[model samples]
Target: MNRHHHKPRLVNLLDDFAFGGVSRGLGIFSSQIVADAADCSVVAVRPDALIAPRLDADIIVVHFPPNWRRIAFLLSLRVRNPQARIMHVEHSYTRAWEALKVEQKGRFRLMLRIALRLVDQVVCVSCGQADWLREVAQLPWHKVDVIYPHAENPGLCTLPLPDFSCERPLVIGAYGRFHEQKGLENLIGAHRAGALPGTELVIGGFGPMEDELRQLAGNSPDIRFAGKIDDVAGFLRGCDLVAVPSRWEAYGQVACEAREAGRPILVAPVDGLPEQVGSAGLVIDFTNPDALARAFATLDNQRLGVMARAARRSAQDCGLDRQREWARLIRRLVPRQARPIGVPVTA
Candidate 1:
């Protein structure tokens, strides 16, 4: 129950291995952690969950769903590796989310409390999310920490910046489930209302809202769905701008990816999206269709080029702080003997 004096083995746990932002972020973190410590691995609860292949080969992986079997497994782990520090990143909940699901609040809070008892820390991806964890979820403030997910995409970083001066309709890329939370409906409405004429909207993702979204678009040639995409870097490369019009976002990885790709982004002024966008992209109140359209209509080649370059510079300035932060945290968990020197924290 107490923090170990020696370098402790670290085990990161997640509810699924699905190819979502959280999974990718954890995969990258696990890989980085293993490079610094001899014993670091990840455990995905579902055996059939789709995991990121990029996870380091040496990092051990375990699969067990949350049940009595998992409790027994954790008990075994606690016994076998007494000094091991286990941490769980709560990727799915927010204070706003709790407000929306009033009936489930009691059970959700209980689950969070019980889950926290099993781990050394509860990592939230954004400051706003940390606030929700500590205040709304009633997690001990000390147990919650904000660790922003890395925005750098290796594939996108390696690609050359596309020609922004080309004579073509400016492409606006948006990737997320066609859900109300994502504000994609608002985006479609703004487009359909002729706010962003002479431009194309390319959406890359699938969900329950797909049918409804398509119905909203209603034979609009300017709107195209690329289905679920695997290569986000390639997708960004084809676009002049990226959009993150979420009603609420813990951390907008798409905004980061857009910045990393040096493409200007238009993000809803909410939560982590604004924090990520900074001065590099336009932040509009997507809830109002007119405001969203006006923001889109103002984009010109000159402004787009300037913002794109700013985005790249912003991402560069942030550096790989996530690695260093992880290193510092992991060092505190275990003794000096287990901590490797110069673990190459950079990706």
Candidate 2:
């Protein structure tokens, strides 16, 4: 039980537990935040593929059906745990909108509006997302708080550092969902223009743009696609540097994760990425392929080491402790309330 303050019982609402950076960060924070007085529960909209086995015994897991039954399930939860503070962690607009769309006509939207209104606090992982909740979803900005995701140094314990000391092939790694927003196509163009010798580009992760990116990589021996990696830290550890060429990012979790893994990162100055990168990594204008290529050419082992150290230092600032502080603030602002039995917290 967290003893720093009177920890409030919290129910975290998540869409699913997929193997993404956002999910991983939420899992880590949830587990650590409730270490003292706070009792925690996780309600997944659907069955979770990646379960956090380290969750405390007091933490309950409830999986609801994908359809309309979710409302009834949540209603029952409120009846059972009237004192629990509901924390809806919005990860995607698609999932949140879909859930909101379930009610007939505009009533669903109204219900969703009312539902979030009941929450003690709504947490959005990125500022862009917080904006979306306010503008697109019509959630009040005052109720929605931006809690940037955090990552811990994996250290040399689980993942061993690869021998990147040689003046060998310069490995440039780009990781993320293979979607249009990732800007992988632009990165490919930059790599082609740069045409730097002894440079190898490896893109990791799977998404809709797999075929497009694969074709763009061509049959060139210098470029390779490693596909989706289960152990991101290990993959980053083996690479010389990481790149985030996102067109628009709510929060570039890849950049933060790479930093936490003690790897140098090059990111497009998009959304919260620049704020996330700070002075820790290189920020490039992704619109210009020639400039991106030139930036890639300049990256050497010595430069990588300096950036890696800075990245680690930056990551430390957004660790589990920082998240707990946010949690404390949320608790203080909202306090606790009593609700009717069997009535949904949102309703």
Candidate 3:
């Protein structure tokens, strides 16, 4: 059996596939590079021990969050697939989120350590997240790799940046799940205080907090709720400014999409958001009620136009070269094909 003649089999194990960046990134991976590089498939699996049996592949990439109770499931996976290269993609869990949510710090840290040992490598979506793994989780730099989220929009570069040269109310757009983690309330708080006097704030998405958020808006003509937008580009195209006021984000997908459309983004200084802004937009204390208002107050037509152009340039610089990065990662992880286990079937 000549190993040089065979390509490695790669399986992406997804546990939580709700509406967010983790699920979206997997969608991109399926189409972008890995599928072309090797025999690749995306499979959804539960964290339960019974379902966590060794996946049939040369490489198994885990796209799931860690749990203390699932330590047995993880260990069993490694034990069963002793010959396979295992990797975990950390799409969530940052230093700020842990501080805000996890009360038992020591126990949580121990759980994370146990989980990390089960996999050969970690795929961090943002540089900031990798930094957190090193600074807070004490994970070695050698064990992790940073691959930023990227999307391919053909006409984004040609689309003109949002024009404020005409006399119209500033169209400020925010889109994502209406969850507390998203920090939509911070944006609403600013709009409610009459801080953004002439701006039209359009928020697109639905979640558990819909009714509550609607009530907070309270019969205001300027604030509108756009339920479940399928066209993210169309949404960004209509806006003068985009807001990503996440309390904790592994990487801001909307921030990336907004940049692709040449729209200036306003992101909170939390987790990977400031890293996403990267001089293309503004990074501020956007989560604070007072600061949120002041943040929007400083933005004018001239400043926004400058940022919009910068956003387009930033997106151009990033491009779709990440496809190559993914291919390289897979080839580096498993240099020689050990075996071909199974072909991917949709579940």
Q: Which of the numbered candidates is closest to the native, going by highest TM-score? A: 3
Q: Write model 3 residue lDDT over 1-347, tens digit each, in one string.
A: 43344577788888777766676666556664666777788887765644366566778888877887677777777777776789998887897899899999888888888888888999888888898887656688888999987655456666778887889898889999989988888788878887677889999999999999999999999999988977777777778889888899888888987887888898888888888786678886765667666776788788888889888888774655677788889899988664533434221
Across 1-347, the per-residue lDDT of candidate 1 in tens digits comes to 34333334445556566777766776555555435654556655444333222222222223222333354455444444433455556565665556654476666666556545665666787887787677655678777777777744667655566566888888888998777779898888888887777889999999999999889989988999999977888888788888888877878888888888888889887666777776688888866877777776677777777888888888773436776766666665444653344332221
- Predicted candidate 2 versus true structure: per-residue lDDT over 256-325, tens digit per residue: 7777766677887756677766656688876697676676677666776677777777776467655676
Model 1 regions lying over 4 Å from their true place: 1-7, 30-34, 46-82, 104-118, 139-141, 158-167, 317-319, 335-347
**What are the runs in model 3 whose C-alpha is more than 4 Å off?**
1-4, 151-158, 317-319, 338-347
Q: Total backbone clashes of model 2?
A: 5
Clashing pairs in 1: 6-334, 6-335, 7-334, 7-335, 8-334
Candidate that beats the other on lDDT, 1 or 2, i.e. the better one: 1
Candidate with top lDDT is 3
Better of 2 and 3 by TM-score: 3
TM-score of 3: 0.92
Q: Give the TM-score of candidate 1.
A: 0.78
Candidate 2: C-alpha lDDT: 0.62
Provide the lDDT at 308 for model 2: 70
